[model samples]
Target: MNKLLVITVLVALLALSAESFRMPRQAEEDQGTLTKITDAVKTYYTDAVNTVSGYVDSVKGLQLEEKAKTLYTDTTNVMSTYAGILQDQLYHIFYHN
Candidate 1:
């Protein structure tokens, strides 16, 4: 009976030790996924800025200052949208867990 009790305690300790290792492995994976998402968002924002720059140049070339101003305002709106998406993703990743 004493030998059986000792074996049971050892088994439980081993199980918990295994679980400790598993938790950090899962956390590392989650961090990697979050990093990828952040990188993609940065790329998208860069592309958006480039598009606005090109549009401004084209509008200026055509002597359409009013249209250029409107496009600039629209570009600002798009940047705000991107900012909102980034904030939501950060909240979901950091707080939802």
Candidate 2:
């Protein structure tokens, strides 16, 4: 009877130790999954920020292009007016002299 009791106690202790080891493995797996989820979220946000920044830069470039075109047109008009005035003055001097 004493031998049977000792055997039973040894079996119970072994089972408890096995369960304790398994719990730690389960916790480690859960922690790994959480880490992966966090990294994915960070990547998604970083991509989103980059996309928005690109769009803003595109819009600014288009605005600058429009301003450049307007300035070019205004400069051309001023040059044409100056040329016309000079031509009129030269024609009057040559004819009236």
Candidate 3:
């Protein structure tokens, strides 16, 4: 009867220890799932930032191109006006003299 009591106590202790050990494994799996979710969120935000930055840079480049074209057109018009004035002056000097 004493031996039966000892065996029963031992079985109960072993069962409790097994359950304690399994709890840590469950906690570790939960932690791993949380880490995966965190990494996915970080990647999504990083990609979104990169896309927005690229779009902003493209818009800036287009604005600069428009400004450059306007400056070029203004310069061309000024040169044309100057050339026309010079031709008129040369014709007057040659024909009126």
Clashing residue pairs in candidate 2 are none
Q: Model 2's lDDT to the true fold? A: 0.75
TM-score for candidate 2, please give it: 0.39
Residue-level lDDT tens digits of model 2 in 1-97: 9989967765654454343444646555454544555556558769999999999999997898889999999999999999999999999999996
Candidate 3's C-alpha runs over 4 A off are: 1-62
Clash count in backbone of candidate 1: 0
lDDT: worst 10-residue window of model 1: 13-22
Per-residue lDDT of candidate 1, residues 1-97 (tens digit): 9989967765654454343444646555454544555556558769999999999998779878778899999999999999999999999999996
RMSD of each: 27.5, 21.8, 21.7
Clashes of each: 0, 0, 0
Q: Which scores greater on lDDT, model 1 or model 2? A: 2
Estimate TM-scores for all models. Answer: 0.35, 0.39, 0.39
Please give the lDDT score at residue 44 for candidate 2.
Answer: 75
Candidate 1 vs candidate 3, lDDT winner: 3
> Residue 32, candidate 3: how far off, in angstroms?
21
